[model samples]
Target: MKLHTIDTGFFKLDGGAMFGVVPKAIWNKTNPADDKNLCTWAMRCLLIEDGKRLILIDTGIGNKQDEKFFSHYYLHGNATMDSSLAAKGFHRDDITDVFLTHLHFDHVGGAVIRDGEKLLPAFKNATYWSNRQHWEWAVNPNDREKASFLKDNILPIQQSGRLKFVSAQDGVSFTDDIKIKFAYGHTDAMMLPLINYKGKQVLYMADLLPSAGHVPLPYVMAYDMFPMKTLDERKIYWNEAVEQQYILYMEHDPVNECCTLQQTEKGIRIKDLFKLEEM
Candidate 1:
């Protein structure tokens, strides 16, 4: 089995929103913000090639939104979903499965594309994977998360008849190497893929921990619906990761692609940072 890092692009989000309750004086030490208080973040996804099963973890915000809508996020980057895939000698249609961690616009927006007068699955050949719990929560979103769960990015997968649910059971293994770890602080049934890569465990740090800058337990994102739950989740995962020597594959970290954690006086902190190729 092999793994590929697919960088969709980068976008800006409010620094305050990215770290709730954590003051700028603190978070800015890691993720500095612009004058407008917006910090740049990458929408990095992962592609796993396991025999006949090719799984894509998440897609970026995409290009279907209007100018006004995009202006808000300040999308900026050269890498894109298609071009990045092509760089690795793969194509969208080559994907066999798309395991979405959640249905946020920045995560699942690229799952669908605009084709003439109709919307359709971006990877027509891929069976889109999402858990039943998150699917229902995303489709029927609450007011706080309604904006993030765009209909065009989501409904199309189901409409295209390519949607599949991950086994609702936690700690389940979809393949011989990839296991599922569920977290609810970010959203209901947000599944994080735990891959046994190169004989080492690599945890895909979804929204539960978006970036390396968020490693310090208190740097929780305001976007998380349950900040306390995120704290507990991180404590449990980080400790286990450090104890087991797990590598963290960050999804939204703009500069760092991956990292290993070490127990620190300031709680869990980065032990070493490097590209996946370094593995």
Candidate 2:
């Protein structure tokens, strides 16, 4: 199996929200904020090439949103889903599967597109994968999260009759080399892909660990539905990553694509930072 980094460019989010209760004074050291207190973050995706399947995990915030909508996020950068796929010698139609961690706009928006009068699945030939729990949670979102779960980005896959659900059972195998690990704090049943590649285990850190700076405990995001649940989940995942020597593939880290954890004197912290290709 081969994995490729699919960069979908960067967007600015309020640093305070991203860092949660952590003081700007501390987080600023790593993810420095602009005058607006927003920090740039990457909408990094991953591509898995395993024989007949070409699975693209988490499409970034799409281009279909209007100017006013996009003006709020301050999206920037040269990399895009199409361009990134082209760079890898593939195209959207070539993807056999679109595995979404969750249905948050920034993560699943690119799964659908606006074509004239119709909103449709971006990858016409691919089956979109999401869990039943997450699918129900997103479509019927609460007030706090409704903003993040846009209907246009979602419903289309189901409308297209191409949406499929992965079993929410934790550690369920998505393929011979990929296993789905479920987390609920960030969003209900967010599925992280635990992939066995090149004699190493690479766990896709969806919203669980957005960046290297979030390695430390208590650095949870305000966007999480249940912050305390997130804290507990992190403790388990972080330790497992360290014990198993898992290379965490980050999705929102602006600079670092991957990181390894170490049980330091101060607790589990980043042992090293590198790109996916470095492995």
Structure candidate 2, residue pairs in collision: none
Worst 10 residues of 1 by lDDT: 166-175
**lDDT agreement with native, every candidate:** 0.91, 0.96
Q: Which candidate comes out best when scored by lDDT? A: 2
Residue 161 displacement (Å), model 1:
0.8
Task: Please count the clashing residue pairs in each candidate, in the order shown.
Answer: 0, 0
What are the per-residue Cα lDDT tens digits for candidate 1 across 128-215? Answer: 9899999999999999989999999999999899998878788988888999999989888899999998989999988887888898
TM-score of each: 0.98, 0.99
lDDT of 1 at 272: 98
Model 2, residue 69: displacement in angstroms? 0.7
